[model samples]
Target: MFIELDFESDIPIYMQLVHAIIEGIATRELKPGDELPPVRTLAADLGVNMLTVNKAYQHLKQLGFIQIHRKKGAVINSDEMRQADDEFYERLLTSLRPLAMESICRRLTKNQFLTLCSKIFDEIELKGGKC
Candidate 1:
């Protein structure tokens, strides 16, 4: 698992860690059942606090992205990924709202915005991973 953290970014370290791990899973760099480094080890490697890694792991578990075991440590969720339900669609819309607003404000046409989205989807799919 290769994770690059931008120390200077405005986003919180824990959230960045969560996103990185999620991206890794999406790209198939982290397959189901893969074990993540222990919290203390990952923290030391990333130069972040153990609490941050723990928090990120907890969040991922909550989102059904990974499972944490006392002895097994953190493993990618081996079960089939959860299907997107209404709650997920709601969350997705909430997350995309701000970006949509920004795109509108920036005068990005609907087609252009959709093209960008398609480009991203293509890139991810080309990496031979399902989203």
Candidate 2:
């Protein structure tokens, strides 16, 4: 719920909103069944366009991260979340490939890269994240 947007960043506002919400869920700041602010309200609160918030919400729903209801608005999905399947694994690899390549180009050792990944996992776990 505490989203901070970097207006000057190269990232698109809608993607940043999506990432922030996903991070909130990961950190347990947004638990199952928690209702998100209405799109118009959140847009006004964040000084962003309602369409931006709507786009992010739609993406979240598509990604199975949240559910949208006409009357109830958006809420964190209460059902048990899906496990990583082949599709997810494929997407994960696609996402990580560039980062891994960049790390290699920067001369980061395999152990160092893995250590960084482990550290991130540890931090997320410490914050009560499920993944």
Candidate 3:
């Protein structure tokens, strides 16, 4: 599995990691029972602190995206475990609302916004962008 991190991004590294894993699941790149890299190993590879990876792992586990095991490490959760979380959607909308409103303020049309979303999703599903 490939995970990308943006060091210059405004979003926190841990949160970005969380989203990256979520996208991995959404793209079907990570199926149930697939083991993830060890937190320390991934952190070292990404040039981030172990704590950041741990935080991301903890968040993913909390959201039912992955299961943490002492002996087997972290693995993707089953599909049934990946049900939509309302709190997650609420947080996502809260984060995007400002940017969406800004686009509206810039006179972006609903069709344009929807088209953009569609195109982006297409690219994600086809080209498999991390989002």
Candidate 4:
């Protein structure tokens, strides 16, 4: 769970934590039944507020990436994670809509945008990411 943060970025600290944890799970670095550091401890290590870590954990749980138990705290979900549903796909498209618009506004061709996406996808795939 070595989550690096870019305080300089506009992305919220909580989101950074969320993305890092998701990436770790995707890459198989954090396997099923793995216990994550408690929110307070992880926040201290990351120099972020405990609330930020708490928010990340909650989001992860909702996304089915992790499960939070009363005593067990946060643990990665089962190895057989659920497949994305229609709602998830719709949300994914909604999230990417703005980026697609931005690319077009910048005069990027569809091929260029797709190429960039493919490059990033390959980068993550090489790291054992399931995404």
Candidate 4 pairs with clashing backbones: none
Per-residue C-alpha lDDT of model 2 across residues 14-98, encoded as one tens digit per residue: 9999999888888899999999999999999999999999999999999999999989999999988899999989999999999
Compared with the true structure, model 2 gives a TM-score of 0.94
TM-score of 4: 0.95
Query: Against the unseen true structure, what C-alpha lDDT does each candidate score?
Result: 0.93, 0.93, 0.85, 0.90
User: Per-residue lDDT tens digits of candidate 4, residues 54-108?
Assistant: 9999999988889999998999997588888898999999988999999999999
Q: What is the C-alpha RMSD of each candidate to the true structure, in Å?
A: 1.0, 1.1, 2.8, 1.2
- TM-score of each candidate structure, all chains considered together: 0.95, 0.94, 0.84, 0.95
Candidate order by TM-score, highest to lowest? Answer: 1, 4, 2, 3
Summarize candidate 1's per-residue lDDT along 17-82 as a digit string, tens digits: 999998889889899999999999999999999999999999999999999999999999999999
Model 3 TM-score (2 dp): 0.84
Give residue 123's lDDT in candidate 3 (0 to 100).
66
In model 1, residue pairs whose N, Cα or C atoms come closer than 3 Å (at least 3 residues apart or on different chains), thus clashing, are none
List ranges where model 4 is wrong by over 4 Å: none
lDDT of 3 at 11: 95
Off by over 4 Å in 2: none
Q: State, as a TM-score between 0 and 1, how close model 1 is to the true structure.
A: 0.95
